[model samples]
Target: MGHCIICGTSVDGVVCRSHQEDVAFRFTGNHPNQLTPGRFYEGTVDGFADFGVFVDIGDSVTGLLHRSELDRRLESLDWDEGDTVYVQVTGVQDNGNVDLSWSIRQSPREFRGEVIDSPEGDRLPDDEPTPTTETEPEPEPEPRTADESRNDEEPEASTNGGSASVEPQSTAGPIDSGPPERVTVDALEESVGERIRIEGRVVDVRQTGGPTIFEVRDETGAAECAAFKEAGVRAYPEVEAGDLIRLTGEVERRHGGIQVETESLKPLAEADAEAVVERLDDALEAEAHPGEVEPLAEDPALADLTDEIADAAGAIRRAVIESRPIVLRHTATADGYVAGAAIERAVLPLVREQHDREDAQYHYFDRQPLEGEDYDMAAATSDVTRMLDNRARHDEKLPLVVLVDTGSTAESRDGIELLDVYDVERLVVDADPGFETSDVADGVVPDDGSITTTVLAANVACGVGDVRGEIAHLPAVSYWEEAPERYAELAREAGYGADAVRELREAVALEAYYQAYEDKRELVADLLFAGDDEVRSLASHVSEQFRAKLDDELETVRPHVETREEGDVAVAVLDTDAFTHRFDFPPTALLLDALFRDLRAEHDRLVVVGLDEADLQIRSTEGIDVRELAERVAERVPEGGVLASGVRRGRLSFLIGEREAVREAASEIAADLAA
Candidate 1:
């Protein structure tokens, strides 16, 4: 009989049956049959297959954690071979094969207690000291150096140069060896093939097919250190990201970058870790903020948002310094693309300059285009999944999510909250003034009709890096109508004339519709920042296509358009479903924009209504609130079940069965523009 570790109740083993679920067991038996069903067991990842992962519970017994049992997709599992994980033994087959299920409790600290389950009986783990009544008088301990402390905690090297065995701490250091002097990661260039020690925080860890790479960051900079255990195996299962570690290795130039071939790596003691963290904090504080960069063309609206823009820039710079990924999510529109491209131009240069890796730019910065103006749940969920997968698989820090021309309205609150749940740093830059400014974002720059989102992002980008010339024309390109003279002049100063800017805007709009989801970073960069000849050639060709497509769509819709007037407002209504191509180029939003521009030339106060079977789009010169319009329509025609879906795009949803009534009500509301 034994006492339960938690309640001290008498039981057959160390843990009672009622408390078994709360404790994790270390299997000591050699066969699969020894594993008790429904009991959690600590296991090491043996290998992975297409169907599932092979986990070894003990020396001889292996279990299959099938993909179906995983909480996430099989490809999303971040566990490398030899990583210690927890699993529940679901059953043992007739042939002694074991089936395991995923356990929510991953870390041992999450469990109430740990026990050793063997063929003899269950017992406590070896590390759990036995309680004793006798006490011994302790002698005064001598002060130990940081190197000696690390040596005591270092894992014993295996004879085959595979997995390591952790041994109890010893008071004495290695025989006939003195402590190695610590060096910064930046100073490793001069010490190729030389063995040296470095102390830094482990910023990231990635498990490759051949070796485990640890991204170590000291006060000077960050660099990768490769530690080999076995192919497709974790080198040091105990060391993880965010740990302060002391590592001794040989500096070697690998694949055109500096890498450390690790000989010994271990966590630093608390005091040493704190000292290193303090040093890193001070250094990051000193270097993370970029030099002051003024806005290209200042407006009072932008001036009011100066603090927010500075904060956004600071957040981006700090993310780069900390080696965290930067994810820019923007609306899939001309303005949004311009905004995203401006920031991308600024960030890519910084990423290249900051990291030594050849592929660091692609790895650190990402731009994803959202289909709608709002960062809805779908987009946020996708972002969360990708970020979590990166963190789990690569041990990467959660990225800074920058939402440009999206994630500002009340409709995006749910998505913003999801990011908030993960404590992700969010920076929003939108021209929409209806955004929540309280606690939804770490930094936000909301404009009031004076500037476009591209202008805001360009200003923020200037603070991120020195890319003023590269993105000077983006602000002018974002404006659908005539851009402000100041921004147009700024573009001219940057070598882009008014015709060049207009052509680039049209080219981006056309391209943005084709691959509505893709970022098209290279193509956008060429169109915006390529040499004058290339830009003019590409932009002119693409803009020709844009004009042709728009003209074709307009010709088809013009004949079907019906004109109505209530009081002084001219209302042009088009049954978009019947008149326009549903799946072709010039999407409804873009089509409506062209129609509005054409009809606006005829009437002073006009509203263009693109009416579909289930939804309607409105474009007005009167600055009508789409949400309020939807409300009035819903009250007038209750059977339509009308709802305001997208405010920025002036979109409303209604029941298909009541399409005619909804159309009439929407047309009536559109006439209210004259009011």
Candidate 2:
């Protein structure tokens, strides 16, 4: 028996079977079994087939390099008939039909392995690394010799006289030999701005507009490392997913997360490939799960909805880790903005943590509000078009659509069904529990009148541990009318007073109308979370402007509003299209909300119908069914199709031909109900 050159273990030859593949051995035997299944071997391109390329391994054997084993198409193969290449034997059948796969590195010399045979058993080309003394502290390793240059260089095609070859050479010199100071991906947070080295297998490779992002997974967790070559050009062209590589870069803290700017990346030898892959597998198995959730201590009722919250938290966390983008859809109101912004704040940080791109927040997370209380087919079509464009241009994965405050009712079924056709991930975090939202959404956090959508979103944010402090006052900002006691305290503790919360609510509402197309990201965030010093003055100014405009419109419209008593209920009707400013500040929706709340405590609100041309919107309070009223209006004027419009938005429309008849009929119904 002889000692193995690598581990110094006793074996039948100079190299053991475990480390035999590490050394590229020249085949001396005449049998097909002598070739290692996975070891790269030198071969000559014989010819091409429709399915694969034929390769001549040695004088006695020819292998078929199957097209299925190639990373790209078979027609894209650039090798000529006589050109030499490298391939791995994936399988050898009973018929001696050798099946081969393409190898990125055609030169076996790029690897650390080298073995030779004589009259005696096999022997390695070099001696094992010498052991250092244990008494003294371990010093940095010395530079490797010419024969050990493979320890530093990245594996690719090695040239021999301008032609690809499998022979090892002494041309390239040694590299930094000491094992790089290794850090797990999870430890990147504490080592921000510190230059560190991390070794892991590449799980994914993405090319962005600026740089190439490689998601590397080590024993602790996964993180993105960015390497730049040029605009739209791939960095580290030879590096592919599943390659075990050692990356050297500085840990940068940006984008509300941590990323490594790669200075150097060297693919490790095949000898340690198994170990690296196993370590990554074990780390993923152990760390893939999101942390367990605890109910918001401030709200005990959340305990009743803990399971759904946990599921939401898990889905969000998984999306971040797996590099899936999040698209948030909310109602286009103050409450909707608050809920959408809260999740945006939380998810941005996590997105920054998971990805290493300056625009990763925008790429990974989106906050889109519905037109009103309805997420109809138009919204879903827009989402599909936008996401499909992103997928085609940037090669982005399908995003997780998070519906906030809306999309819980059956009204959003068609929109949800459209998204379902693409198998998109949907999560609904809503306060309304009246409808079966669970039938559509993968996870639904529905609380019946107990909390606001912002509170539910904040709970999910807190559970995920991303946007904690930033969204403190978001719940209070959502309450334009009245905030719940628990969330109000949270806002107060976050340094926002009741007056400040009111100003923010009014400001967000005002801004949400003009740029109804946009999320008003920075403006809303500053007003809600940045405090009195930064945005309070702006908030106060905007609030004054908002109130002044709202008052003027209400004063002008109220004098013209026709009021009638029916039984014990009083109905208020206004020609909103003519009386109020249609193109100006306060939209009909906000105007009605403020007008109704101003009169709710004093007047019995059977319904407030705002007639605009052929459309009518109803703000019905005191449990007066708007649907029934719409039906009555339709029956009174048979020619007018003044029927119930939508189940959720309390809307009805009349035919233009019968507008005058509907007007006459409305006055009759008002007088007949007088008690």
**What TM-score goes with each of the models?**
0.73, 0.62
Error of 1 at 337 (Å): 1.1
How many clashes (backbone N, Cα, C below 3 Å) per candidate?
0, 0
Off by over 4 Å in 2: 1-203, 207-219, 223-303, 443-447, 466-468, 532-534, 624-639, 642-646, 660-675
Per-residue lDDT value at 5 in model 2: 57
Candidate 1 lDDT, tens digit per residue, 102-122?
Answer: 775689877777889999988
- Per-residue C-alpha lDDT of model 2 across residues 1-675, encoded as one tens digit per residue: 666654555677655544443445544444576665644566789999898999877656788988867755677678899887877676678888887875645575644455654334455545644322223344575564452354346432211111111222222222233244678888999988666788887767876433567888888778888775543357777776666787766687544566787756667655555677788666544454445665444676576777777678778876776677888888878888888887777778778887655567867788876776767799999999988997777557788888888877777889998999999988888876665656777654555566677778877877666556667777877876778877788778888889988988888888888768787788888777765575578888888888899999888788877777765666777888889999998888778777777666767545566777887766656433445667788888877978766544556778978876776565445333321
RMSD of 2: 16.6
* Ten-residue stretch with the least lDDT total in model 2: 157-166
